[model samples]
Target chain A: MSAAPAPRYLARPLAAIGRPVLAGLASVGRMAIFTLTVISHLIRPPFYPREFAHAIMTIGWYSLPVVGLTALFTGGALALQIYDGSSRFSAEAAVPSIVAIGMARELGPVLGGLMVAARVASSIAAEIGTMKVTEQIDALVTLSTNPIKYLAVPRVLAATLTVPVLVAVGDSIGIMGGWLVGVNRLDFNSAAYLKNTIDFLEAADVASGIAKGAVFGFIIAMMGCFYGMSSGRGAQGVGKATKLAVVASSVLILGSNYLLTEVFFSG
Target chain B: MIELQDVHKAFGDKRVLCGVTLTVPKGESMVIIGGSGTGKSVTLKCILGLVTPDAGTITVGGQPVTKGDRDAFLARFGMLFQGAALFDSLTVWQNVAFRLLRGAQKRARAEAREIAIEKLRRVGLKAETADLYPAELSGGMQKRVGLARAIAADPEIIFFDEPTTGLDPIMAGVINDLIREIVVEMGATAITITHDMTSVRAIADDVAMLHDGVIQWTGTVAEMDGCGDPYVEQFINGRADGPIEAVR
Candidate 1:
């Protein structure tokens, strides 16, 4: 009897797990269809140029200060860490080249992209998710305005354009931070550190990082729009969607950072 | 001006609306009354194309409401949702002038704000209220702002979905009276869905009782007292026992 009950309990748990797995698959299928529908709507007419312009200003220009501050500080800290670590092996001479390459190829774009994903993704999801909960999305449809074009396209475009620029600026500042640390902290000459950084960093490293930034930007905005549009009814639903957007964007950024680095750096 | 013919809607295994049919003539105020979950709100949503009926036809101003053309069809109608449904990010003036600032009716910001403030005043709100957000307003004031927005474009048809649901008796009466005045002034066809008898008596020219997703009886306010239908009687009198089941 005891053995029978144990097996029955195990069966129930197995069934419970199976149900959610199926449900999750179904949800993914529904989301795919919704995404396709949104894309189709995006290419159609009745475009709202004014709304697009406003979104670009809000998502891109307004977000610059936060992204800039994050990138600058991260670069400065990275330089300090690299200098300390390299001095252990009596390889202090390699500090300038390693810092320059590391910042341009990985740290600069990844940190900048992650910071933006936090700021931009959360804001987009929260704003649009609230609109969805309140039936304003329905109201927009009733008013003959296409919600995808008015809401999604502008955000996606702004992130795509702005993140690359953010990455580029971040790369320059990060290299400058490394240069400062190599000279001031590691007792390296300022002129030699600057020359070494300039010599070691190649155009491909910068280009690849910026390219990753653009892709990261697209992923961040897409996740935000997707979650916001699919938010369920009421305040709790909006809050959940906002949290999911931030988490999803952050995960995708880190994962993509690895993949992009592999692609760019593999021998 | 709005007519539904044998409308039917079901969610999964549960049937909410089962062949509901009703009509509201032009320049008239019709109030639909029903207990909760009997499809009173669903009927209004069907008419507005907010909810698509599984089977049946809904027409407005003699034109059929096709699925994709809901926007153009809805443009002629104004709606006050159950909870006001104001945009939280927008100021009171912006919410009121939303439609006016879109499409062909687009106005300059200053002009839109001026019109919005005027409408706010018409709803008995102060000019300073226009700069505030909907969150800052009282429930009654939010409903008033919703009313202002609904009538802002002077739509030929207006829908009030439980306009008095969350208000006190006095506030509900005020809203009912305001609705009556606005409908009369605009000469527009208005459909209001409510369970509030006070709202029914105050605003309805004709009253329709929806029981079990069908119109049990429809008549003028004078005729409602003499309706004689047991279901209608049970509802209007708020009796505990009647022919209608208390449980599903």
Candidate 2:
């Protein structure tokens, strides 16, 4: 390619095709390195306890209501849909088992992480991006504090520790939602529904879902920090970072869920 | 003393600093004056290792700037940013005592606060202002807070970037005076970058003019008065027509 004198049509189309592909690959590589750097910083000394505590409260505790509501409605609707579909085949008894398995394997952690990504990632990006624009990040460095250590490490630690706990709570709320719909609308016996749900759920299933929650949480926090740190010097730059953080985290959450599911559940 | 030799830096195709060199002797204030985008800030950043130069050797106290313990190196210096850059999440006092609150310089809470309040007083801010966040302050007040923060740690060296950028003339004069007084009181090595000629006169023990990524002239303020260099003359007088293009 470096030695070639290609025709305009061929060169133009090829260049257009190659440019985005190369850019995409380069971005992926950059994100991978950023994730590694965050992880590396985690084990280092001089931890900022106050910042970590603040992040835990913000990322984990404040996220509960939204994640809880999402899980509850989703589980109840899933139970309703399963009952309707199962009745066609006279398989209505499968509703409880299906809801439990579905919530445990997929919806609970995936949806909870998505909700977190939307809320926390955008906030982190905007906050840090504004810091970058206003030179606050540079101020951190000039004060002998590393920006990554002060900003990214605490947030990442908080998300990793809290998202799984959020997933656990979300899963329980979702199961309860399924139970409510089953007993009230589907005419399912409450005792039997609860028993089937208990019987269908295994320890491995719960663990895998929690594990996925951790990975998704990492992706969300990392994207927020990376975009924020790399933001250009203006209000528009910060806005773009906020937008990109949300979009990237959301897409990554869904995509990683599929891959995680395949690893944990596929034959 | 801080010395930069043949420093070269570029962002993509546009060269910001090319073969630039200068020296700031110990315990003296050196003000770098230039038009916008003339690499004054870039030079300051390179000395502090905020922006790595593509090529050059920068030495602080006769040691390479890029080597040695970064935290230890940075701790020796303080900086006042163009926009104040006080952490919005922290109060004014916390911003001032930021270096004292953690890491190797950690001080007890009371001690840190005492120092912060003293610094604030020295910068002409009231003790009540300590508890207020940066958002609560006016632009001039923020600049004062920034000055207080820069002097908080009693650093051996200090850098000020566009210290009077947004202040009114009176406030600008006040800040310039405060900076001059503090630099004299501390007897610390100082480097300041500004396009404001008034600030240049008020703060500089020595002056260096940067133009098109190179040092156009360097001398004491008295020497600068009649140096007879066209670029320096035009910049100092704020003339429209000169060797430098107004649009470029």
Candidate 3:
């Protein structure tokens, strides 16, 4: 007798779900192991000073032009948008103050953070990911060098220090962008716009943005290095890791931006 | 000398290395032959500390490799990857001098470049090739560059993973000759993993067959062809209808 019709469709979906769940769990486990390994290596010695310097130069110094340009345009566009929106309520006079405060407290840091995350995160991930795929990381390990100490720590440290600096620069440039637009497009006097911007912005606003920059920086570098070290062994694996690093860093920046804004602005 | 004492490695439910035990005396060339996915590469990785064994002790020069001092253990060896995994970002010279450009081995930039060029020349590459990136080179050239980099530091122990997998017959012979010459010149202990019998005949003083994650047969090159094991016989003869079944 033919067996009762087997539930083929049910079995397929069940197996599909089971496979992804297991894969997700395995990925999480691998991430945890990698994180612990990196932290452990950070505490060890024989640190490579030269590699650290190179990372600073590569991730921090080389990234300034793009960060600067992005901030400048964002600030200008923001000022124009504020002007256009505020005119409906006869609040055009508030444009300078709003632009200054907004850029310093949120826009500058978050946008700048996202920009750097896109640029630096992809690069770091691609470089390290390729190294991993090709067994260069293994070669490093064989050469008596701790891969994390030689690779991750330097990039992470550089990003942490450099991103805040980029934020500060971006904030200033963004404020200037607002000033230029406010004076030209809005027909506001240059002196009055500058005074309003300076008066409305406080040290706390700048500090908060810089602090956010530091956090974003950490996330960018951490995600890049993390995905890189765990990349699979092929060109496709490196490409996938690079794409994931950028996407993850951007998402983390936005999410953490909200949390940080709440913490800083809660009072 | 390198010794693997009953090593076993498994990934989750899939056991790759069941009980692999082998030895390479100092200054000897040992070639491990196996088909794809039979754990040949894993064995080399385990010896290099890249892949840890589930149960085994690997010792290099009588020092336990499982200890925390992987760097110290690794410093004694150099490896040529299956893909000739050269750094694409760096120029050929920079890739060759990767180790020399850092730490105590750090040389003056010019000296480093010079040495890198010299190594490149030894591998039959022109000095002009030193400024080129790995991507600009053909597969055979990349393999030669990889060989040059492997011997760049004059390592006491060397590992060659599939040295002749993707090359033409003539290029493969060139690589085999280079490997043999380098092993003899450096007086280094060499472990090569490949299925190429030509490479085995050219470079190996001893031959080991890896099957089911263990050394199924091992003997001197002279004795390899005469090994009575059916697996060895099938593998050396390239016969499909023998003990080894095609997975298809």
Which 10-residue window in model 1 chain A sums to the lowest lDDT?
A1-10
Question: Model 2, which residues run further than 4 Å from truth?
Answer: A1-4
Shift in Å, residue B192, candidate 1: 1.2
Model 2's TM-score against the true structure: 0.97
DockQ of candidate 2 against the true complex: 0.92
* Tens digits of per-residue lDDT for model 1, A1-267: 345455777889889999999997996786577567656766677676766677678767776777767666766687778768877887777778887788778887888888888888888888889888777786666555667877887777678877888888888877777666666776789998888888888999889989998989887887888889888778888889889888888998999889988888888
| Candidate lDDT (C-alpha), each | 0.83, 0.93, 0.89
Please tell me how candidate 1 rates in CAPRI terms: acceptable
RMSD of 3: 3.8
- lDDT per residue for candidate 3 within B168-202, as digits (tens), equals 99999999999999999899999999999999999
Q: For residues A40-94, write the lDDT of model 3, one tens digit per residue.
A: 7766776767777888898888989988998889889999999999999999989
- Docking quality tier of candidate 3? medium
Question: DockQ (Cα-based) per candidate?
Answer: 0.48, 0.92, 0.57
Best by DockQ: 2
Chain B TM-score (model 3 vs. true structure): 0.98
Ranking by lDDT: 2, 3, 1
TM-score of each candidate's B chain against the true B chain: 0.96, 0.99, 0.98
Residue A53 miss distance in model 3 (angstroms):
4.0
